[model samples]
Target: MKKIGYLILIICFLSCESETIETTTVNEELTAQQKTVTTNKNEAVVIRFIAGLSEAEKSVLRTHYGVTAYEKCSCGDENLESWNLEAIHEGATIEERVSSMEEEPEMEGADFNFDIQIASQVPTDVISGPIHYQNVLPKIRSQKASVTVGVLDTGIDPTYFRFQQPFLHNTVLDEETCGNDFFGWNFIENNNMPIDDNGHGTIVSYMIYEQLVNTATDFQILPAKAFDTDGKSTLFRIGCGLSYLIKKEVNIINMSFGWTTTSSAIIGSYIKEAEHNILMVTSAGNTGENNDEIAHFPSSYPARNILAVTAVDGEIPPTLVPILSNFGPISVDVAVHGIGLPFYTTAETAPTSVTGSSYASAKAAGFAASKYQEGTAMAVFYHKILLDKIQSSTLLQIKYASYLDL
Candidate 1:
């Protein structure tokens, strides 16, 4: 099969809430054009090809089209070779491009590339009140390594004291093909150390750790750094991250980041493959737009065990509409505290304040982890209970069948 290039269109804007002051940071670098994959005029945007290509077919691809085959990365996921590829060829259109190759004597009816897509940009911040998830923990059945939660973001701050709690096991994954990482793989530097340079991942991981780790000692947190120090990543990296977690048999995955457009087919396939095995919790984005109108990936990806969470402030008749959060009575699954909440950043030991849907999603994932059971994690059942346990005062009464609607 011909591999197609997948790009991730990421847009990030962050805000923090503190008792004394508030801060906002807008990242203008992430956009559609900026995020698109670039190839020379003579190169073709291909990801991976079907295995067992005859010698003749290989010659046609290399000599005739100047296409070069190479491994996607050292992440060690077999799907990486099947889902991501790059080559050099000229084609007027995607269909036409394939037709020309098929015209060859041995190439007739041969499949080549799979469609690719850009990734969504997901965010964080917090507001405090009566603790969420407190009541739900006792109801969950806990066991050692009963559930593993994957945190895919910039990276985690392993040195954080809060994360050092004996009950909390922030287990580091071994990227054997590459080496051993005490924390997680840094796809940016292709290194074992996935320490957070940007503060986004730290906040995302911290929020979840604080909420669930101590409550559920048997629950494990696996950090998979998909984004770089600048808070940017491609759909390929995101896919690899998911694949790694899936191999680890993680029960829940927290994607505190998002993209506004449809997700790439390759990543979608991975999500589909893990549909029954994992539950994905993604942020609704910080755009404040309606996701029902303009879909967000992983969140909008119609699949099983995927929950899209929006932000809500801690107020009487709680404000489900965060000034910087995206919502879709139809697209989002729930709303939680995402206003001015105190948390830690990569650069600081003391707690700082932040606000966004990313934080809300983390909170939701943490809650899900608390309730998750390896063999009996019924998506619908847990979803119902989650909605039931959510602070009634903090939830919005929407028309859609959403957690907030409860």
Candidate 2:
């Protein structure tokens, strides 16, 4: 009997081991495929190297990898630096160059910024109850303050009626004079026009625009077009946009996009670092998985400045949680209802209804921006004040997996 019991234990252990190995192999395979799809086969790729490059090191990179341009990035530490570079070499693949560079002592931490796919969710318009913003304006007018909110997504259509409305005039910032940027828009494609060929950015930007307008708040929208017409961008471009916003001292940033795989460590590092100073608001993704169980970058990152938002539906005793919106008690910070909400499109197009945590994130970001206070201490306190207002006990009851109770 003892021998038989020992045999059963061994069999159970072997079976569990086999299952674990199989699961790991499948996960690795899927991850590899995702990485491959994200790779752009274009002649050029973006690379970030350990910073503080000597003239000799820069010359070596220029000669060896055909580096065309480079910029220094401070990944949290001003003293510790990182360099973003655009390079082209006919013979070698990006992976090959990365591996070769890693073997060199000086270039140990060199890495490529992989492409980031947009979190696309087309919203359809629906007649909904009032959100109190239009009414809330006059009451809070005395407390209103000027704030800058950076929309890091597809470009906004400033010609739209919401932007053109006389009451909302001069809310959009003047074109940035910085390198490769334009007034009210900046594109990663190096094009002078930052128009939205895809409607996602326009829709996302409107959520913030409408909120500020309705509340009669003094605010400016800095539209940074990191994604292209296909709704695609890379960590390199996104990082550049973030750097631009940081330099401008924007009080809040809205990133209504994300990816599942931990593909770009450098970009992840940037997100983590940005939270040190600016309020970073991001979507919790649409995967429907618990982010705490399966992490999401920028959202699940352990940062006090990050407000990870998930989606809820219907207000008057809100109950529905979008089937696709990711949620977690620990990972997600708040929830907002944007599903089936009328989204503003281009001047030529009619408004449409939209879904996904993308809109939720935008709404939260706009709310946070509306509640912005000037001082560093006020910034923290006011953010909490806004959160308290948002996480009402009644509303908290309706949110899925929400930890915030007010």
Candidate 3:
């Protein structure tokens, strides 16, 4: 047990209009260098409704729309008249069903939805080598961290030696708060035991842990697990997870996963609401595409509190190497050393080599926690402290570096 901490989170609140964030593509269409998991389910559609429903109305849904089953994400005030959810129908794909709901006059009047945010997985495997844990990073500030980072992803392995005891923060516990025995909220199972079934969460956790440990920063990790063994966080899950983190009042959030969508009002509402409260650090994704063209939330979300982090490789100075991380001079705020980095996993005996913007964002989270100025958090505060913003269009785009450089 190297540290100790505490937790709460509630989700986005906004607008009377129902929504359909079209997360249609998996967005992993990359070269042979990049690989990711793309998931497409044809049976259901996620919907966000803005009206309070009665049993009579629910019955009508069952009788008319064949809504055999539905799960609602109660991420906001129970009194609030909004329901983010998904339902299973008899036939047709998610897209078709969403279209059907919107066109149906009765459902439209009953608070129908738009924008389909499909799910996606990040690029896990990368070029590899023997894991190395013996490097002296240049920036080691005397200042210890005085914040909590809510990690939204697959849960972490508390069984791991590093994750046990004080590593996990304890929060107010009860029927409404985090259970005394758990690390954070598990949206996947709607419980407090957010143990990592998939290794993605552990890898991301390990990165932030290592950075803080090596830097001698005092901090706690709040595990807001929304993804499970399937390693996917949909719109509803993300909302539930964000709801948890916000309630916890974490200083920083590390989101190493994303989905590409144009109309992301569902997710954007949260981003806009949390703009002045919490600072969000997210991966620009490993798709190697320009984020300006393909908006990846909540990174691509136009918010002052959200930062889109990209990945770059090689030692600083003369050896910089570009990898497959997504980037846009405007969309992506900065870059970090995220290529073929060494990380640990609970499923494996020792550390392994992996690449993706996920690790980059994790590193950036630690950096933000180290540099976070207590007071009102402004995204531009971190953005302005860049060591040097690259200006040469013809030169190598290696201008990005860890905030420690400054």
What's the CA RMSD of model 3 in angstroms? 11.1
- How are the candidates ranked when ordered by lDDT, highest leading? 3, 2, 1
| Tens digits of lDDT, candidate 2, 3-99 | 4533453454345442310000001011110111234434334454555767677577756865655544321122122333344357775567767
Q: Which is the better candidate, 1 or 3, if ranked by TM-score?
A: 1
lDDT of 1 by residue, 1-406 (tens): 0011000100100111121211223232323211212211122332333345665655455445434553354453542532212332453444455456445443312233322222233232222122122221222122236666788877665544455543222222222323343334666567654555555776677777777765653666667777764566665567667777776666888987766554455567667877876888888776666778777776888876778887777665456663466777677777767766665433334444566777778887877777666577456645543655434534443223334321
Return the top candidate by TM-score: 1
lDDT: the better of candidates 1 and 3: 3
- Stretches of candidate 2 exceeding 4 Å from the true structure: 1-45, 49-56, 62-110, 123-145, 165-176, 179-185, 320-322, 344-351, 378-386, 389-406
Which parts of model 1 have CA positions greater than 4 angstroms off?
1-71, 81-144, 166-183, 345-350, 384-406
| TM-score for predicted model 2 compared with the true structure | 0.67
